[model samples]
Target: MINKKNQETLSHHLQKLEDISPKQLNKDQKDLIKKMLELLFNDPNTTTLEFENAYRVLIQRVKVGFTFDAAPSEAKNTISLLVKDEEKSFVNDPLKPHNQLIIGENYDALKNLLVIEGERESKVLTLFTM
Candidate 1:
């Protein structure tokens, strides 16, 4: 059985997280982003590193507001955003391969992505299926 001290610590952390009531991102995205932050954040080893609100990515996506371009010159890469939370998150694991599907064949795959991406608190989603 878990010890009482550990339990209390866990409880307190849960309460703090609940009180904060942060929004959710897709689990995969959230995990990926946190790992990126853990490594690339100003300092990797320090716990509780300060950061700006919501995770951000440096790469630019090719979107004409609603639709993305037919091909990025770099082509066939996935962009993921990760966030942090207490529950079983994806931090510390190697990132799963993003589907680098080509540009024109993205619609059906986009729909499928939503099926897998549906579980988390992700209010936003993007699909770059080939």
Candidate 2:
């Protein structure tokens, strides 16, 4: 829970935050402002550590954009392995890596590719969308 002195400080900052247009502030700043207001009005008993954790989570969500159910990190970690069809071949060239055709949800495919890329020592990614 916040002490009287800290509450005063938060109130002062919140006042200053309200004066600025939200567009002028970055995402982190905006999330901070939202959390600050919530803390001041809704959950006064929330501890500083808890407030900080919630603030960090808000910032993370902003960074990851839209997601459903689990957080992005958790979603990424749980990505299933890409299924390879050795029988299907575009070219018989044994010297070159074969192009893959992935069939799945767009976000899931992209996240799975990212996880695969991260495991390698060198990564080069190129995307073409139509």
The lDDT for every candidate, in the order shown, is 0.41, 0.60
Steric clash pairs (candidate 1) = 29-82, 30-82, 30-83, 33-82, 101-130, 102-130
lDDT of 2 by residue, 4-105 (tens): 866675666556555655445565777666676575445767666665565555445445664346444555335597876778735658886677666766
List model 1 lDDT by residue over 11-126, tens digit each: 54334333431233334544455455434333433333232222222111111123434564532455434444568654444576655446786765565456557744243433
Badly placed stretches (over 4 Å) of model 1 are 1-24, 42-55, 58-130
**Which residue pairs does candidate 2 place in steric collision?**
none
Give each prediction's root-mean-square deviation over alpha carbons.
Answer: 25.1, 15.9
